[model samples]
Target: MKILVVDDDIHILELVSIHLRQAGYTVVKAMNGLEALKVVDREWPDLAVVDVMMPGMDGYTLTKKLREDTEIPVLLLTAKGEMEDKERGFLAGSDDYLVKPFEPKELLFRIHAILRRYDKAVDRMIQVGPLLINRQSYEVVLGKKSLLLPLKEFELLSVLASRHSQVFTREVLVERVWGFDYEGDEQTLSVHIKRLRDKLEKLTNQVKIVTVRGVGYKLEVSE
Candidate 1:
């Protein structure tokens, strides 16, 4: 897999690149967000390790721009270990966050975890019932008809559909869809669920996602 390591610190960039290369990945190095964008435009990497602080464009802006174009997984590296910083990273579209002074093994583990999650998402798309999510095309289909979905809505549906019939608490949904450090209110999940239900209602009268009342929610496949 090809991976991009973006950091203003040359030493840090080289360190990460060396370890990632050792782990059998093609490593691409970028010193700043502008360079990162240029590199991404030329070559699409499977994953990116972006440092939060940079000279020209910051990592948050880079991550947001990248997310707007593609769903390629991004792991943000931050020097600040504050919870708010982590939350901001997630809000900006980081798939994972790692604090500075992290172990190389931990970085490798996180990369593997993100890749595993992405693979599961791909597998789930094939069996999302009447709903078809084409990641490559960024298109959603309900049966033979196409349905338009906002980015967040698509992400929410992807997570729930992946574990059809399994109960996912509001917290779990927030973490999985919104990211672990998301500071948003629990009502956000409810609002998204309602919107998703409305859209899917057009396809099938029966609700695929069921409310678990006091617990959370679950997706039910109709027979």
Candidate 2:
């Protein structure tokens, strides 16, 4: 997962980035809220760690702006420990808050907890007919058999299974499975869908990935 860390303090920015990287996350840093917003447009991080106090565009404003268009989770960091400050942070749409001078381990724990909560809320486990897609474990199981798929293919399946029988445009699928900045063409999507169909055919015919002619694709689950 990717994390964006915004802090006016150079030392705090580097410290947080180093710890997040050590915890196996891609880290992007910004010195202020304006820079953080720019980085977010370019990076599309899964979460953001923002310092509450800044010269301009304070963390509260930044968090509110982020929540306006995207659901990216925010964790506020501040030196203030008062309840009012924390309440303001929450009202700004922060998923969690951490006081400064915090232990690195505690930061890591909170990040993990926030991510888990998001995962649970965003399709942690999806069941479509006889197929099971476990987002938490990244596993796809059909009855007693497990289907091993490449990461992209698995992500594609997960996206489709998240909303069974829902039509997803090729553009939308590409953006979700591959990043918005993906350079590949729709052929990449076609190939993956073909592979997924072949795999499913070998196992069971209960589920099918059907192309909606001029529209897109949908996962059809039969009873």
lDDT of 2 by residue, 1-223 (tens): 7899999999999999999998988788999999999887666678999999999899999999999967799999999999999999999999999998999999999999999999777856788899888876777788799887889988998878766777888877887899766897779999999999999888779999999998778899998
RMSD of 2: 7.1
Candidate 2 Cα misplacement greater than 4 A, ranges: 124-151, 157-223
**TM-score for each candidate, following the candidate numbering:** 0.56, 0.63
lDDT of 1 at 3: 88
Which regions of candidate 1 are displaced past 4 Å? 123-223
lDDT of each residue in 10-54, candidate 1, tens digit only: 999999999998898878889999999888855557799999999
lDDT of each: 0.83, 0.89
The alpha-carbon deviation from the true structure for residue 132 of candidate 1, after best TM-score superposition, in angstroms, is 10
Query: Model 1 Cα displacement at 106 (Å)?
Result: 0.6
RMSD of each: 16.1, 7.1
